[model samples]
Target: MPEASPWDGISVPAHTDYTVRQVPGPTAVPCFWGRDRSGACLFILDLDGDHTDQYRKNTTTINGIDVDLRGEAGRQRLVLTLEEQIDRDLFGGLCSTLIAALGNASDAPTSLAVALAHIRRWKTFLSGRAAHHLTPEQVRGLFAELVFLEEMLDRGGTAPAAVQAWLGPEMSHQDFIFGNTAVEIKSLSGTERSTVRISSEDQLESLNDNLFLRVYRLSDLPDAAGARSLNDQVVRIQARLAAPEQIESFDRKLVLHRYAPLPEYDAPLLVVSAVRTFRVAGDNFPRLARSGLPEGVARVAYDIRIEALAPFECDNDLVFGGGNG
Candidate 1:
């Protein structure tokens, strides 16, 4: 940022919650944490070192942009850094998790860059830090999963599949036959706040009945092997519906049941968050720069959070929670 005018320094709010002093003057400054309900800093100007001017106290816009100094130049020029805007856009876990970790896209709140920086740290976050992480290829396999959901959501989000068992001795409802497989993925380097799931079983249940695909994403480890190691119960069930020669059919409409044990973790931070699921679709993980979320993964939608920790928790005493982050 350019140097501020003389009057600017006297009248502008640096926006920094904390400031570092240097030989010349103040050096670095902190940014907004987004959870300060007490409101932004208030300015009380003093004329001869006494009572002078005071501005109303309230939170101001946190763009990390220019200061709002009433156009004073020359000796009135000043320079200072205010706290940049924090990334508290994560919408999961009751707006509590988002209250922590204040900072800008450069750092804190676990930016995409930060998540990608440490394969190990990323894994830690995915494993115990956050929820599941969807790989690129697996997302493709779940196209039908998301597509079916989208169609359902478009059409009231739920409908009776009507594919019940044989009603009478020789009768049934709608004879629908489909295969379902449950898949689980694990990720160590997925974007921090980006929810990674092509289609979750809960959302699918909201769409239809007699079918379930439970996907559990594991994020305990940094590598794929680490994820697999967490829950190594590899139960691979393929589609088995092409049976011929008087095969015993199950339901009138096959209530296909599939599951994917995705990388397990603390929470399921989806790509889409509050108030804007349909607004953004098929974007990408917040941090990791994958070729794609598995081709044809067909992302129904996702919410991306710029911050890593929860909202307004950055400036808090426990930002790093006992230090050493």
Candidate 2:
């Protein structure tokens, strides 16, 4: 527990939110998600208001334990900044606990591992629902917002284009169509912050039509993962496989589009199957496409380079955790 704000004393910082009396025992901090605060930590993770009065009257429990934001009946009423700082400290402690428990630097306990797995599962729920986009600076903010979100829940979301990993203008059915197995490419950039949504009938149609190609950040060398192109990725993967010590850096572009690398037959190879309607499996849920496949369905495989899937411009706000406070 933390000591309440000392407003009764002297100095005060402008951005401070509130103060609360220190309780005897320690508490676990909840993971934080969405906030209009951008990268600022001046406010509580999910709290939206500055109702000092509320702190003065209410008793609430974070997780399950009761917390009296207000100082005991006679003590100085709690301030908003006090509560904000306490929550911040809690969030930090939780991060360290999660990382260490996960064996970031050393071996952690099994219980912690299990707890982290659960958190990951829960985070997936949040990532699936994030309709909003994040900028690079916002994405890598020191708070590790997404990482925190993951610990809080138990699942995740994509950081599309952080490295300029966009849907390239080239796709090939020949690569995706493999004796009953389909593979579609789903890539991301090395430094992008926005998440790409894999929804919609057509999008789902493509995913259903072929196995998804989810190429993300992978590095075999010190600075190699920072490379930004399919060519770079290929080169790095090869170097690592051939001679790991020979490579210096490994920064490559992310790709998750449909593809196949067949060396036996290179002459006008088929990439796409004739099936117009198909099923779609994704990083999240699975579904079947409603519309027909692309034109000229006779080819077993078609080299349909990605022209453009489409842009998402939904007007709705992405409410995190169903906006639960």
Least lDDT summed over 10 consecutive residues: which range in candidate 2?
A: 246-255
Candidate 1 residue lDDT tens string, 30-59: 222121123322211101211111111211
- Scored against the true structure, residue 303 in model 1 reaches a CA lDDT of 30
CA RMSD per model (angstroms): 24.7, 21.4
Q: Which stretches of candidate 2 lie over 4 Å from their true place?
A: 1-50, 53-68, 71-92, 95-202, 205-217, 220-288, 293-325
Question: Could you tell me how far off, in angstroms, the CA of residue 308 lies in candidate 1 after the best superposition?
Answer: 47
* TM-scores, each model vs. reference: 0.17, 0.20
Error of 1 at 61 (Å): 23
Give the Cα-based TM-score of candidate 1 against the true structure: 0.17
